[model samples]
Target: MSNVLNTFLDENLQDLRTQGLYNEIDPVEGANGPIIQVAGKQLINLSSNNYLGLATNDELKKIAQNTIETYGVGAGAVRTINGTLDLHVKLEQTLAKFKGTEAAISYQSGFNCNMAAISAVMDKNDAILSDALNHASIIDGCRLSKAKIIPFAHADMDDLRAKAKQATESGLYNKVMVITDGVFSMDGDIAKLPEIVEIAKEFDLITYVDDAHGSGVTGKGAGTVKHFGLQNEIDFQIGTLSKAIGVVGGYVAGKKNLIDWLKVRSRPFLFSTALPPGDVAAITRAVEIIMESTELHDKLWDNGDYLKKGLIELGFNIGDSETPITPCIIGDEKLTQQFSKRLIEEGVYAKSIVFPTVPKGTGRVRNMPTAAHTKEMLDDALAIYAKVGRELGVIQ
Candidate 1:
């Protein structure tokens, strides 16, 4: 390697280590469930995005196995070529019904879904008013569009309205769009979609919502857009099959014309290999499960509330989270990392999240309690938290 490249890597690596920002990944021994094994130690896992615990569901696993036997492992080619399989069609149809949209289109992953969908619609001739705390994928997508991005304070409806008025009335761009995450993942706060929709209507701005964290956790499992009954009002509804759906893929659900356009223009769909047939089949079934009943959804909320109440009672700062995601805020970076490390050592796998995932000095150990966590598990984890917190002087 070149000397300049080596120096750059070495300097940055040392800087991140000194600042406690370098994250060391731990490999889970088996399926990622309520109880996970890391380095041969059994731990109560609060770090997984498996909200409903469907990733390990027996029925979905069997379905995937059967489908793979029939369709083989890969999709063979890109969608525009010969990769579009019957399972893919079924998955999109199910997604459309699940999201309450006229049609839908699936992609390889949630991150690239935003990358493809945003740039496919908005361009240099347009401007987007994005929420300040939107996901990195959305931020990168906006940059890729070459559209003028104007950020509004996180969930500040008044600020969004003001920006919408300015961008739409300035007469500089051909179109204006407002985009936000349905639920802010870092703090777990639900976006003010109702207020945002009102502002979009006033300014005639196109509405886009990425409900990656809200689907199956809110709106009786439909999503945040449906949570507010704004399905008809919002133009674009984006979601991921990976998180709540417990599969691996992403999709955009909207009107038929939008779906039709994305099938042709979205670069990921046109270029990247399609999601595997078995995964597609399993994803279709997962959405059906979410739509059929709310048992898992209700249980997930119950677990979240139970864990949040326990953390708060023990004098931990879990920020204002409306969903099952609980973030234990620790302001100092080094202390936050220490808190997480101690928790892991004590047999609780709650990892630390710091800049640039979140702002500096606002480091947190984000917890995601799923439906699969029993009361006994939560009680055990809480006890461990109390011990760790006291030992670290984070609590009384």
Candidate 2:
């Protein structure tokens, strides 16, 4: 390796270690479910994004296996090439129907979808009014578009309205776009999409929502847009197949014209190989299941309520969470990390999130409660939380 590269890596790593900002990853031994085995020990896992527990569902697994036998492992080429398999076409159609849109375009992953769609639509002549706490991928996509990026306060409607008015009136750009997360992963708060859509109409701005955490967990398993009944109002409804869908891919659902444009111009679709056939087949079945029945979705919410109730009753400051995502706020970064470590020691696997990911001084241990987790598992996790909270003087 080059000496300059070696020095750069060494200095940055040392700085991270000295500041206690370095994260140590624990590899799970088997399937990542309600309970996970890590380093030969079982822990009540609360850190995964597997909201509906479909990742380990027998039916989905069986479907994937069968599809693999029929279609093999890969798509072989980019969608623009010979990779646009029949399964890919079906998945996109299913996604469009699922999102209640005229059409949809699938990508390799949710991150890729953002990178592909945002830049494909907006360009250097446009402007994007983004939420202050929008996901990193949105930020990157905005940057790639080379558009003037203006950030408004997180979930503050007044700020958004004022900014929207200012941007539209400025007359400095040909197009204006507003983008936000349907559910803020860190805070577990649902975006005020109805308000956002209203503002967009007033200012004639295009609206976009990334519902990575909301799909299959909100709106009877449709998504946040449907939850508000604004599916026709929002221009772009982006989602991930890997999260609640229990497969792997990302897609943008919108009007047929918009999807047609994306199909012709999106770089990822033009350059990257399509999602594997088995994964697409599994995702299709998963969406079908979610559309047919809300059983898993209901159980997910029930578990979320149970976990949040226990955490609150135990005197932990679980911030205002409107969804299943829970954040037990512990102010000091070191203390927050220590609290998570103690939880792991007590057989829980919640991870500490700090600066950059969230604001400094608002460090927290985020818990993701999935539908697969039973009442007994939650009880045990709550017990561990209480024990650690007491030992660390975080609770009574």
Candidate 3:
């Protein structure tokens, strides 16, 4: 390795450590669920994205095991080659039904879905109006498209409308797309999809929604588009099988033409190997479960409410959150990281988010309450929270 490259890496890593921006990953010893084990200690985990607790579901596991037994583990080659498994086809079909779209195309991950689909449709001649609080993957996708990205205020319909009008009237591009997250992961706010759709129609803009955190949690588990009854109005609905679905993959559900185009034009699908048979089977089973009932969905919201109420009663400022995602805001970055570290020591595993992730000084310890958590577990976790909040001078 060159000395210059080594120095650059070493300097940046040292800076991250000194500034408290370096993330230390803790590995889970077993299956991820309502509770998890880390560093030989059991914790009431609030850091996982397993919103519905489906990641370790018995039924899903059995299906996956059976699939692995029958089909082997891997999908051999890329989708464009011999890797388009019958299971993959079924998974896409089931996802389409769950999303209430004409068709769907699958990708290796949610990040890949955005990276592949955005550039496949838009290019340098197009412009994209993105929400300021949009996910990093969406930002990366817009950049990959080589489109002129214009960021509007987070969920501000008026701002979006003005930008849409300006971008279209300028006659600067062949196409314009408006993109946002259905549910903002950090603040847990739901996007104004109905208003966005109305604005899109007025300006003839292509609407894209990355419903990663919304799927299997909102819209009776159909996501934000279906939550607002605008499934057909939105041009693109992107989702993840990893988050609420509790599996591993991503998808884009939309009109048949869009699906067909993505299938052919998306580089990841054409290049990367397809999802393993077991994962595909597991995802198919998971989507079917989400479609068949709302028991888990209701329980998830119940747990969320219970946790939020407990935290509020204890005087913790969990900012304005419309979903189960709760952020325990700690103003200073160093204090925020300390709070999270203290929580882990106290047997809760919520993580901290600070600068470069959220705006400076808005550091927070984010919590994700899931369906599998019992009232007893939440009660215990809340007791720990009160202890830590007082210890850190974050509460009375």
How much does candidate 1 score in TM-score?
Answer: 0.99
Show where candidate 2 strays beyond 4 Å.
none
- C-alpha lDDT score of every prediction, in listed order: 0.95, 0.95, 0.94
Evaluated against the true structure, the overall lDDT of model 1 is 0.95
lDDT (Cα, tens digit) per residue for candidate 2, span 1-396: 999999999999898767657788999999999999999999999999999999999999999999999999998999987999999889889999999999999998999989999999999999999999999999999999999999999999999999999999988999999999999999999999999999999999999999999999999999999999999999999999999998888999999999999989999999999899999999999999999999999999999999999999999999989999999999888899899999999999999998878887999999999999999999999999999999999999
| Pairs with steric clashes in candidate 2 | none
**RMSD (CA, angstroms), candidate 3:** 0.9
**Higher-scoring candidate on lDDT, 1 or 3:** 1
Provide the lowest-lDDT 10-residue window in model 1. 316-325
Q: Which candidate achieves the best TM-score against the true structure?
A: 1
> Model 2 Cα displacement at 379 (Å)?
0.2
Could you tell me every candidate's TM-score relative to the true structure?
0.99, 0.99, 0.98
Question: Which pairs clash inside model 1?
Answer: none
Candidate 1 C-alpha lDDT tens digits along 1-396: 999999999999999999999999999999999999999999999999999999999999999999999999999999989999999999999999999999999999999899999999999999999999999999999999999999999999889988899899899999999999999999999998889888988999999999999999999899999999999999999999999899899999999999999999999999999999889999999999999999999999999999999999999999888888999999899999999999999999999999999999999999999999999999999999999999999899
- How far residue 235's Cα lies from its native spot in candidate 3, in Å, is 0.7
* Model 3 Cα lDDT, one tens digit per residue, 128-206: 9999999999999999999999999998999999999999999899999999999999999999998998999999999
